[model samples]
Target: MNDERDRLEDLNIEEAVGRSTPPDLAERILAAAGKRELDDAVTPISGRHAVPRTHRPTGRRMTSPIARKNWQGAGVVTAFALLFVVGLIAFILLNDPSAPTEQDTAETQEKTDQDRNQPRQRFETPTKKREPSSPDSNEEQPTQPAPTDEPEPESEPDKPEDVVDQPEPRAPVEEPQPEPRDTVKEPEPEPEQPKEEPVKPEPEQPKGAVEQPKDDDKTEVKPEPKKVAVAYIPEDAWRKYEFGRYSVRRSASDEWNSIHGLEKEMGRIWLYEGWQLKTGTGELYFSNGALLQLDGEVEFHTHTRGLRIELIDDDLYVDNVASSSTVFVTHEGLEVEVGNGAAVIESSSGKLGIFCVDGQVSAGGKLIAAGHKASLSNRGLSSINEVTRRDWSHPLLTGARLRQLGIEDFDPAPLGGMISGKIETRTAEQLGLDDDGHVAVDNGGSASVAFRFDGDHETLRGEKVRVRYRVKGAKKLILQMFCPARNDNFGTDIVPGKEGEWNVLEIALSDLRNRETHKDAPPPGTVLSSFALALTGQDDAQIEVDWVELVREAEFEK
Candidate 1:
């Protein structure tokens, strides 16, 4: 047995790799390969490499022991392959210190067999129900362990070997023992979801929810009692039945009803047509809040609003013109407007006189100031004289009756003619030019101060309308001419002059633009219904009009 063991030891792994090789072994190997040796081939002896025993030089690796081996064609290659495979397996078994020992493997294998024989208790990896993720969190939400129906994953018992680290550190497969531990976990109950209630449609308002009133149950609105227009005589006022008396009638075709007594009610309770007080004096009141005192022959014709006194020649005093009402006194060619004031208007043979007592008067485009006298004619107004003591005063107009109109505190200081029938009269001072009395207006958000002229605008057709006036807080000043013959409105905006001073703008009538077409206006014929000057801008603006001058200019070339 000892001889056999020695023999086995000798054949264990060929020879030691440190043994030197023979010189002629290379030539023999080359001869077997059927090739000649290289010219530079030199042999190197193994023992004393610094010196050579033979005269010829040897190769650097000629003395190696393994090269001297007498192996044949494929025998050496096969031996090397077997040795490499054996070395790889030995390295795997011995590299890791944590790798199982032979005793440990045997113990574990014995335990595994015992466990299998008793009964395989299949263990399942606990699966979890994933929790709902929060909208703001980036991390995955951990899951809760839940009971599952699937059995244990016993089929992959050797799965840890595959999961272990790669070959260099792979042998300690038992260290990753989570496969069994991950299977054991306490079961967690899932959170119950709240149930949502079903939404029902809302019912509309029931038709019978509110009871309808029957014909008898319905309430009716009582009609408002209308205030009637009235005229009565006051006992304190004096009157005369001398030459003629006051006459009242309904229509123009009806006969005049004479009023001679001191009867309180003279005019009817409604609108009447003819009124002629041609005698000493008369006092009358219309329910429209208009009080009138006529001195001479004064005739109040028919009117829809207030009185239309067509005086051929008479002195008529008016007061307390009700809200939104007018008292038109049309004489020869003179237009005089008085508001809450006394004025004696006289006319004798183409001559007229305006005597203002308490307030200002606008007569023939001239402001007749209080305590001043002005001569009025067909031409215009002139001869202004201040009176120390007023010679003319109203006998019956005591100003006590204005309270019945409810506007006793209201200032109707006449803003001149806003239009034909929309004229409010009162003496107003405007700026420093109040010596001639100016008009300030606040027609309830109407931003205009307009004056209308009934005189001949035909002569001014081809001329420039030069106006001299002082204004405050106004924007554009518009001059308009309404032609009845053409039935068109010709208007032009005057460029503003120096501020805080009187402005004189000479605008040609030919330059008036057609409001609709925004072009030069055509010739406005002789029949112009209204020639007006209006200021537009700044609410409640004031304007003092000195004069509306016309310069006769030759017609422009077409």
Candidate 2:
């Protein structure tokens, strides 16, 4: 059994050696061994048989142990050569320094195309692991790899021909999805809006010539007529009449007869320039409702429009109850326009007076209200003063009217005795008192003048006396109250301030009693017969007195 096992071992070894050996391997081993044997043969062999040992070839394959050993050695040599070849191939694969392969080229081309189409990408730097260093070191340290000696490749301009042809990578296939039944498309962008400008309004058209439609046919437009202000009179109207010593004239024609004292046939009468008319003791009435009464001479021209009279001289009174435009002009250049009532105009050398009795009158640029008087002069008009009841007295006071006061002899002796002066009564205007025609006492010579008020004794008892006087050269004035029936009297002296100016003096009737000297003086309620203005010891003094009035003390205070 041991011999059989040795044979199987030897056979298995022989098979392995045969598979590992090359076809020319035996010839190479034989050539190397034959040469070594020949060299050994030259060393001169010491044997009787000097020939080398040679074996004859047989037809059958040798299976000797020595042949098996040779086969084993050849197998070992073949295994070693195969291992050396594999190591060389692995080294070449790992350390190859060539350019990119085909797949890498495809990926690079796709990345470049994406970069050109999409927006630019910013490369992020890789973070490197930091090595801790000693804090004591002050030398500058390199934070990154140092620059290499190799020059960078020049970036060539991209020519169309230099671009390589590469197939685009296929995108991954996705699973098929079900199609929706309805599709909604996105709305397109709206067109740009236009800017707007401000709009203006239309202008207004005129009134008469307003714009009309083009289809209108009316053409003629009549303008309204203007108004006219005038009065029409007949040719045969009564235009001229004569009264007392005056010749009636109409526009310079003096053929008209006198219509004086004719009541029914009275009408308008026109007086020419310088033609005087006197309405002597009767009023002259006109058919146009004008009534004129003259105290002295009056020359006037009558306007046909409104029967306006222009007075040339003297004084006249008009009752213009029927006309509103009945105006009168004075010789002193005053225009007195009366309306609806009576008015009186008195004209003298350098003065004019207008009194509105019942209605308004416009005189001297001012309206004289009813019961008022306007005293005007060449210096224009003064302030209008209220008219008293005595202002409407008779226009003229003659000697006969003065004699009716019981002083028939024209003497001052019957009443209070006068001073060494002549007493003259004149119009207030003549005495430089421009009041409306009130009487004034003028003292010519001067020992002091005295005038007595001749009224009932009981009329002024217990009444206050108010006197308005204008004095020129008198320094003082005295008023005396006397009861002639009782033969007792008392007097009060006044030092007049504002010489040559009008002043008012008021005295209570009770205050006139002489309490200091005449203890038997009259009581407060005693009736006084007369009051006198007696100026004593005033030499060369001229005094003009306006008025003296007795009123109740309560009325004077009001």
Best by lDDT: 2
In the range 331-401, model 2's lDDT, one tens digit per residue, is: 64556677655667787776778776655777667788767788778777889888776665645311001
Clashes of each: 15, 0
TM-score of each prediction: 0.26, 0.25
User: Which run of 10 residues does model 2 get worst, by summed lDDT?
Assistant: 189-198
lDDT of 2 at 208: 43
Q: Estimate, for each residue in 1-558, the C-alpha lDDT of model 1 and write its tens digit.
A: 999999866654222221221212332343322211111112121222112221124333233344323434355788799999999986998888888998997999899776743321121112212335311122333333347665343321221111211112112212111111111111111111011111111233343353332222112111112212233433234333422345444333434444432233322223223444443456554433345666665555424443456565556555532112445566765656654344556666666666665446677777776677787778888878875433443343332222121101112222223452132333434334323333333332224434443232342223456666655666767777776666777788776566557666667667887776888565633444444566665665555444444443222111
* TM-score of model 2 (CA atoms): 0.25
